[model samples]
Target: MGNSLAAIGARHQMWESTSDRLSSSSDSCGGPVVSFGQALRSAMETRDDPESLGTSSQDLADVDEQDVADSSRKSSVSAETAEKLCTIPREKGLDAQDFRCAMCRKTIGGSTFSKFETCAIDSKYYCTECMKSGGKVSIPARVVMDWDWRERAVSDRGRAWYEANQEKALINIKTTNSRLYAHAPALEETRKLREKLQLVSMYLFTCRESVSEDFRRRLWPKEYLRSEIDVYSFADLIDVKSGALQRRLNSLLKHSINHVMTCTLCKQKGFCCELCTVNEVIYPFNTESTHRCLVCFSAFHVECWRTSGDCPKCVRRQNFETRRAQVDDPHNTLLVLQP
Candidate 1:
């Protein structure tokens, strides 16, 4: 951009000098005067300006307008790069894939042997938490030194392992594609349903830890809480039906709800019933009570909500439903005639 600006200003200055010289000389030779462009070019050559002294009309004409434009574009790109990075990203040479996270160093791909637990933000090569808030934690100088030393110890491990297991990875990819193809007939309807929704899944943003923990006993049936339970593989052991799964999830979310997506009616930023009385005597549910409206995702106190089985806060949905059902009937079926 600086180069571009210099180039433009140089041309403008040359033009101004040319015009001034032409006008100044035209009065002296009124009958026969040199061409304004010629006088401008000659005047520019005589001037001490850096661009004017050696530059010719030919050089000015040959000035690549594209180059000047490209200079500005490059500057813009650099600015965009800085904005996205926000903070300087710690550089790495390792081909970090599903093995481990870049920030927290957690595993991305867990399976039976690996037991991968969560999803990765593939675009940024970061975990979701790392993407939300940059992983900037203070550490001791000694800890940093030790970590670097340990990392260096396994510097070429990723490359070496990938080289050796390239065939295995290829085979796994082929096997996955083949298995997915085999299930094409079964998953066709499911795929269509997902497409219809525009890929948006309305997941309950409730307490995940407590909900997952609640299913631990059912998963094991007999094993202790600390025992390593095969959750995905041995999920059938629990015999929880699909509807039961949704019900359990909702139940867990309702009871353990805290700072969920938001409170719908009150429009607060947490899992709370603002309408519920603060006093212990008035509010019998106390800290343990919670209610969730699956329709509108609103929650209120158990006692306050009562057995109404209707969302007190879903007036919008009710209006929408009413409008949708309102149709012109010749006999006036929906409304009673005033007559």
Candidate 2:
């Protein structure tokens, strides 16, 4: 295993345990969660500084000196406590933490479109911030296996190309087969082309060598069909595994006999009120909100207007407009009117 896998070596085990806690059904985030370093950092951000807590500048200076003196690392925090900070519902508003980033702990309810990102390997929530800055993405066994098969296929193609061109190569024509005489310019062209192909072939082979076999089959099922591409593509619609009550409502209650599903957002299967939602996944026609976003054109529940922030798509548009105004400042280059 590489250093990146060693980093999550501990937490990945806890994430797998979510299956045991799946049926908790407590009207909140249901299941185990990830590391809580982000949540702890958020708590510290909200705390008042010592200056506002009735402490003098001189006294604060003394306390700060003391804290610096005792800066040695304490005993390691319990792994159990660290994991607990990742899951929540202790308070009413905390249900939002279900969609919190596994790394930064940024919660989702801040906007209509959830900022929470899903891990392709374990199906856990990782925010976009963590993915970009944090480092190499770690995959569980299942996904790594998929990559392995692809690598093999690429290698086979490269080998076949070499076999077809080996006899026609300029070197072979010059020494072995004197009948096929080529002038200097033509030989140069053929040599350059072969070198380029060889470089590309070696580059792909190196990539396969760097990856380990440990991450083969993680979250995806054992029996999924591997298509010409991943037989399972991004646009492919999957049928939901229906529950008894949902079936009853469809048949006996004369409702639109359909399905209720749990989408694997960021890989983990849960409700995060983002691109994948109860209404968006299970019932497309019965939208939660009637008002469609001006940017994405997706409907958001009317209650979005009352929230502290706007929809994610609209927020993106506003940010773009603001940036344009700043960058195109009229005074930056004086435009004298050509009267």
Candidate 3:
């Protein structure tokens, strides 16, 4: 009987082991029968109980949702921080809304604020520190080389010298008929120079005089003028004058005409003498030889006098012989001297 009992116990233990294996496999694969290791691994992978795996389905879901929320929060925070940096005023020791620093009374950095510091005592936009430290920045007025005419004017002694000697800086005019026509050559050239000077001078004067309270009150103020003038501005002016003078001189040298052509007999190109006119002496005068007018220095054809009513060369010349005869003896004396 004892031996029979021992055999029955052994059979029961084998059956129990088989049952445990089947239960584990069914839980892992949702099916019957699997390898022990595979069943254990699968059970671990799909385990949902918090007590066994140190986590639950609800807890994992909560962690994933929390991660997404944290990432979104970080992105939003970064965007807000960037916007704040962009909006912040760059000026030291000043708030965004304030134009002046409360502690230092200096101008704050902002689009709407003036760059200059203000003094409380003088009610002026100039700081004591800046004034004390200045070599030239403290000066009320600035000298710009490009627009120095007015600055020179302000310094009257300098202006007077410039005004008196400005013409010497100009280019001279050239002409072929230097003897007969006095005004045409120099006057024309000087007129052109004067025009150019006037234009440049006007521009300079306007710029110099533009600094005013009324002008500054506008939407956009002019740039601050530095005290020292640059050498380049004066150099540019000189260069312009030199170039113009050189070009004109070159043109005059290359294209100048030396002489003029004119009529020979009766000393006129038009209104021939009564003797020549009545005789029909059209071919009596030479047209080939070049002759310049003594009075006007113009050139004309000698044969042109046959039909011309007046002297072509001497358009403004008076018939003083007729006038003088009228003054001297009325008219008979002129006829006697006519031959």
Candidate 4:
């Protein structure tokens, strides 16, 4: 009996030590903790009456159900509060909600709740602890919109997500937020010039001119070439805002245009404005003077296209089709000579 009692005491001491550790961990995580005494009392009550086990189980079920309901209610309320906070005007500031770390959802900012750092992306507040714990990151939104390369404080998880997706062509300023154009009109012009450069690069790609090498190197990176004009990575956007990208595009465009106009091999790819009698070579990149036919893809002078309202190549193709059809018919005995 003494040995059995000693064993029970040892087990009780071990359980107490484990419970103390558990209590400390739970407190750190802001989770509920049931003390060793309460747990022991509950177990004793259930053991005292064999019939009371079912009642105790039912009570636990009730408590679990109540906890679930409360958790759901809190989640819904948090979602609604976040939505309202997003709707609030930025100029007015978010003084309504108590300052808390956006990353850990921890209560921070001391007594006044005014000491905090803002995330560069959404301007959300974060605590110094969160910032020290891997919160510094470059926001992709600011990189794409403003070409900001400076890192700012964010949640650790948020920083991880951004670093993982930094290379992706995810942000499309044209489709997502076009108001940036209204704010910075020069940016719109830059995009337009880039589009034109994209077209010009097509002509330069097949040409044997020495400038083609320069064009390939300077006419945007290969990854960026796959994306539309509005889509860009942080590195490319930074280069653009720094004026290096624009300078390269201008130099390449000028050289490639000169090569296309002068080189015989390059001119073979050019189109003559058939809509008019002008013998000058025309290309699609010459947007000011040339108009490309939508149906036949033939180039023509913009003024000639405006007057005729038809493509000369398209008209010739239609006439040839008509003659071929007539010749194919047995009813028409005339032999049509193909041009």
Candidate 5:
């Protein structure tokens, strides 16, 4: 009876183990096997509607475009602001129409246009012509007595007289050795006479001395003598009556200095050395002293030719000669046979 009871107990244990295995298999098989991709797809499909998704993307794109447009508008506004900041304001009370001559009532245009400034003391605007006329208008005391009085005083009539006298004076100085040829004295005296006559002419013509030092420099450089004349020696006897010295001095100053050729090799701008012409490296067989290539008519320096060997385009023509000479040569044929 004990043995039978033991066997029954073993059978009961086996039945419990089978029941657990069946429960585990049923649990695993009961639910559908969903893959990671399918689960993600289902989640996404449930969470978002197709129309809503498209609307979201469109909204984001619109926002991005709006941001870009806003940035562009800001850049344009900044550019405009920079331009406005950099622009210079026009002078007050002065317009394009106000630039005309007040006395002659002629439109001042191009190079003849006169620039005017209001006198600080007088508080009146004066054109170059009106100022030169020496009318009752008040002018700066400094401007009237400036060093450029000779140029400021010259008139149309005075200019003609000066030109004629200047020519005479130059001739007289050149032909005869006189005290007038003594350099400073002659030049200064001529300038003084010209200045006096110019002042008189200015009063008679334009009435003011509006011509500046710059205008004088451009128009009459001879009227102002700043340096000592180098054309005459003190030992030379000069006639004070004849204006020979002045003419000689003017001629000497006006003479042009001789310019020499530049070297292509040394890159020197002034005169080239005679020795440099024979230099093989500097003046190559194919290159000229003027920096021109003899073969192709192109230009290059000695240094550039050294690195490139020969003219880039012309060197190809030498290949046929090289091949012909090499093929015909006995030494090349021997070397080819030995190799």
Candidate 6:
């Protein structure tokens, strides 16, 4: 078990490094590095910075350095708390010195240790006294992973803290807990549908036909699905499990398909199978039935493209170019053939 935890931690570190490089590349390309987590944080009220509390040296002199240090330490501890206990390595026994009520900073051990309850989302311990004063909340992790919205008990401070940040879109299960997708077939299915919806959205927005702004807003807010397809918030996951998001995606896709089939501008954007005599207009979104030519980028029936060894369009273009070169300069020592 220790080995497994170590391996997971190593992989997470590697992924973080890769993400850092990608972020740098995105910045270099002048694209905004607006991730799903960033969007969630932006929606919440800004946090107060301990150092920024004092504007001048006179104000700083009046402040107690010890208080600022304690606040900083507490903030760091809170931030280190994992959303799920499974993500971190843990032991069976609790140490009084190590464990404390996350809310009140009360030491949790001795006779009352067994009676203490844990927060489902943050996995923090709460003393019996704190638990008595707390309320119940639908654990965000349970809602996203299990589609379970049943309320669970937590300390009052925990409840208030959760309410302050519940709307913040922190967990992205696909990247964080990929094993869930394998075990939970429903989640994987929803993910695939969402990806297809992304493709459909691209087609609709890029087409010459003007899609209604209201419909776009209803489908997915610009903040959520801006330019990336994989980024999803807790709200999105919840909606998917509840069938609301899936229904919206289906409606939008149906509209897009109808527009493509009927509108002259949209139809013109489609490609025809050049490899076969059977003529049909195929869109890029139909990945199952059509294959695109590598060189000319024309769509063709899957079987027809596979049977033909090479792209017929490229062959014909090359032959025509060669013939034209001979006709233009028959006696030329060197003939330049266009590729």
How close is every model to the real structure, measured as TM-score?
0.19, 0.17, 0.16, 0.52, 0.13, 0.55
lDDT of 1 by residue, 1-339 (tens): 466546645755655454343221122222332222232233334333556346677776787989779978987865543232222234342344546655567555434322222211112244444444332221111111121111111112222332342222011112223343234332222223222111011121122444334534433342211121111111211122123433443343343333222423111222334345342211111223655454444445677678555654455445444543443233436444344
Model 1: CA > 4 A from native: 1-231, 234-268, 271-287, 314-316, 327-339
Task: Give the alpha carbon lDDT tens digit for every residue of 1-339 in model 4.
Answer: 466546645755655454333311122212332222223234344435646434555665667777889989987865553332222214224454355567767666667653566655456666766666665765556544454558766656556655654554444667655776665555565676676665565555555546556665655354354226776544455556577667766776687678766865555555556556665555767777877665544667789889988765456556555755654466764433345
Q: Write the per-residue lDDT of candidate 2 for residues 203-276, one digit (tens) a residue.
A: 12222322212111321231122101112211110010113222322242121111112212211211223332
| Candidate 1 Cα deviation (angstroms), residue 314 | 4.2
- Worst 10 contiguous positions by lDDT, candidate 5: 256-265
Per-residue lDDT of candidate 3, residues 123-210 (tens digit): 2333334433322211111111111123111122222323343332121111212221133333334334433322112112222234
- Which 10 consecutive residues of model 2 have the lowest summed lDDT? 233-242
Measured by TM-score, how close is model 4 to the native structure? 0.52
Of 1 and 3, the candidate ahead on lDDT is 1
Q: What is the C-alpha local distance difference test score of each model?
A: 0.33, 0.31, 0.31, 0.56, 0.34, 0.55
Better of 3 and 5 by lDDT: 5
For candidate 3, what's the RMSD?
A: 50.3
Name the candidate that leads on TM-score. Answer: 6
Better of 4 and 5 by lDDT: 4
- TM-score order, best first, reads 6, 4, 1, 2, 3, 5
**In every candidate, how many clashes are there?**
5, 15, 1, 0, 20, 1
Error of 2 at 106 (Å): 84
Assess the local accuracy of residue 3 in candidate 2 as a C-alpha lDDT between 0 and 100. Answer: 49
Query: Model 6, 1-339: lDDT tens per residue?
Result: 466546645755655455333210122212332222222222221213344333656666677989799989977654453254114323344453267776677777777554577765555677778887777877666655555668888777767666666444455665666677777666666666665555444445444434634446666443344234455555566676678766766676677678756855444555555566664455555767866554454456788778985765556556555644644464855434435
Q: Against the correct fold, how does model 6 do in TM-score?
A: 0.55
